[model samples]
Target: MRTWLRHHQYAFLVALRRLKVQPFSSLSNLLVIALTLAVPVLGASILLAAQPVVREIPTSPEMTVFMKQNSTLEQAQAFSQAVGKEFQAELANVRLVSKEQALKQLQSNPSWTDALGALPSNPLPHAIVLTLHETPDLVTRADSLAKTLQTRDGVDSVLLDSEWVQRLAAILSFIRIGLWILMAGVGVVVIATVFNTVRLQALNQREEIAVARLVGATEAFVRRPFLYMGALTGLLASALACGLALLALTPLNKALSSLAQSYGVQLTLSLPEFSLLLTAAILVAILGALAARWSVTRSTQY
Candidate 1:
């Protein structure tokens, strides 16, 4: 076991020496791999940052029924329950936002606090918000519900402010799908880049591989160094890709923080993102190297 380990370690060392032989060429290839890997890393990070924000967005179309300023929480709750029951099938969720609850929620956001502070008392009225399911006739059903609620006793007005929300949600869904497709395509590019690099390197050593085979060296013996080189390249490129992706977070958060703060969210990427990208890079690099095994075998056989 010790002998086997020592020989493999020697092969890895040989692979390291091969890369050092042409430092410029090796670095250029490594940079190519790094750039290829960076695409997915950046895409995944963007998706990760956006996921929480997207989930927090209330996408279900909502019909807000504002009650008279004098309406009590008890009356609002009773009205909410009645409306919820009336459209149980069409409604995904229904909640009563009392004047106090609404004001308290608004105060939690810094952006609203300044404006709210100027008011002598909470200006928010008691309200029932009906969250409707996304269906073919969502606008129709919500519009009909809003019209019905507008005429209800004690209800001051009805606002159907969710059509745009649903449209935004649909657009986001399409963008998410497009991003996933883009990530997958870039991932393929990384693998292909690795495969071609290893293949070219193996071909460069064809004469050495053929000579070793003549000395009774097995295919495994000749292939080990190439495999090690591929793995090392993967590790290096992954590290570079991880670094670039992490570095991007600074500017990304800088822009995102300013925007996110307005929405009461602290958006930032951390070390976990580094670890995730590194792991992915290693796997992709290894896969690409392993994929070149047949090419190495073909070269050695000659």
Candidate 2:
């Protein structure tokens, strides 16, 4: 165990020295890895930040059950209660809006006031607004309920108010899928970059490796420093990527808060969770190191 620890310490020091020897090349490789990794990291952070905003949107499927013009308020209220009882599991709320109340609401809105005043009689009908519980199948459930309401004698029309929400959900799904693909592609690029970098280092130290092999050095001993170099490269790159992500998000965070304020919603850009970021960085480093080791082993074998 002591020997193993000593070898690892030596390998780590050698890796550090190798990076310092060619600072320009090392910095360039680090920058490339950092920039590539930052794309996905920043995307993931933005998605997390936007998740709360999306959930806060009043996009739960709702049905506006317009009653027949001749329907009495008592009948509308009775119908609403019946519907609420029937869909108890899915119904969030059911409220009856009398025709007069609907007209008053329209009059209060400047956009509808002009059109409403021109009418000789209130053309609005009683409505039962059915807010449904938020679920993955909310749109389908709302449509089913709407169909059931349409068959009732007093229900003139049932309009679902979730089409736009459905569209927004679809858009978000597509964006998430695209980000996953992008992240996967960037991961492959990182591994390839590290492999090439380590391969070049192996070539540069050809004489030293040959002498070590000639002196009875084990394969593990021969490859340890190269593996360490790859790991160090990945670790530094991840740190740089995180710094860049934070720097880039700072101004955007301020802009988003301002926009949220305008919409009367409290919004902030969320940073990537520390544990998740650390795990990802370590995994990436290990992957790069393994790739480099494989490439170096193959090269040295020849």
Candidate 3:
């Protein structure tokens, strides 16, 4: 164990020295890798930040059944009660709002006060806000329930409040798929970048490798430095990418906060966990290094 540790320690130092020997080339490679890695990091951060917003959306009412202008508060309340009784298994809650209550709510809003005050009488209809139980059959049941409510005598219309939420969910699904494809492409690029770098280093030290082999050095010993070099390169690049992603998110968070504030939503953007990001970076680095080492071994053997 001690001998293995010493070997790795020596390889690690050699890798560091090799990078320092060509600072400009190392920096250029690091920057390219960082930029490539940053794209996914930025995407992941944005998705994490938006997770809270998505969670909040599902907690609200799924649909609203509006009553006709002539519908009385008693009729609206009866309808809400009937809905609660009929869809008890599928509905979480059903709340009836009278026209008078709707008018009061409209009056409470400063923006709507002027328009509402000009009206001779309250033109607002009664409504029933429905909170649906989350289930696999939620969409189908909700649609069926809405259609049933629409045919009722006092119901003017049944509006699905969760339609926009559904659309947003679909959009997020697409974004996730796109991000996965993008990450796969970026991973390929990273592996290729490391492979090329290791190949160049191998070619540069061809005579040295040959001399080591002639001296009875094992293939693992010969490949150790290049593997360490690839890992070190990936590690540094990933760290830089994380930093860049955080910096980019600062402005985005500010913009998102401003937008949320303007819309009167209590929203705050969150950063990705450091431990998670670091673990991912390490894994990616190790994978990239292994790929480079494999490519180098194949080429040298040929």
Tell how far residue 185 is off in model 3, in angstroms. 2.2
79 in model 3: Cα distance from truth in Å?
A: 6.9
Local accuracy of candidate 3 as per-residue lDDT tens digits, 4-48: 999889888988898898899889988998999898888877777
Per-candidate total of colliding backbone pairs: 0, 0, 0
Backbone clash pairs for candidate 2 read none
Cα deviation at 81, candidate 2, in Å, is: 8.7
**CA deviation > 4 Å runs, candidate 2:** 54-61, 67-100, 118-126, 131-140, 148-157, 161-175
Per-residue alpha-carbon lDDT of candidate 1 for residues 1-302, written as tens digits (9 for 90 to 100) = 99899889998899899889989988987788777767667766666666676678765587788999988888998889988888899889998878988899999999998999999987889988888889888778878888888899999999888666667667767877877787677667666665677778888878877788889988778888888887788788888877876788788778988988998987775434546665776686676577557557655554
Q: What order do candidates take by TM-score, descending?
A: 2, 3, 1
Could you tell me the lDDT of residue 1 within candidate 2?
Answer: 100
The sequence of per-residue lDDT tens digits that candidate 2 reaches over residues 139-218 is 67777778888998988998888677667778878889988898788788778988888888898888989999999999
Better of 1 and 2 by TM-score: 2
RMSD of 3: 3.7
Q: Could you tell me the lDDT of residue 145 within candidate 3?
A: 86
Lowest lDDT block of 10, candidate 2: 53-62
Query: Please, what is the TM-score per model?
Result: 0.66, 0.81, 0.79
lDDT of each: 0.78, 0.87, 0.84
Instruction: Give the candidate number with the greatest TM-score.
Output: 2
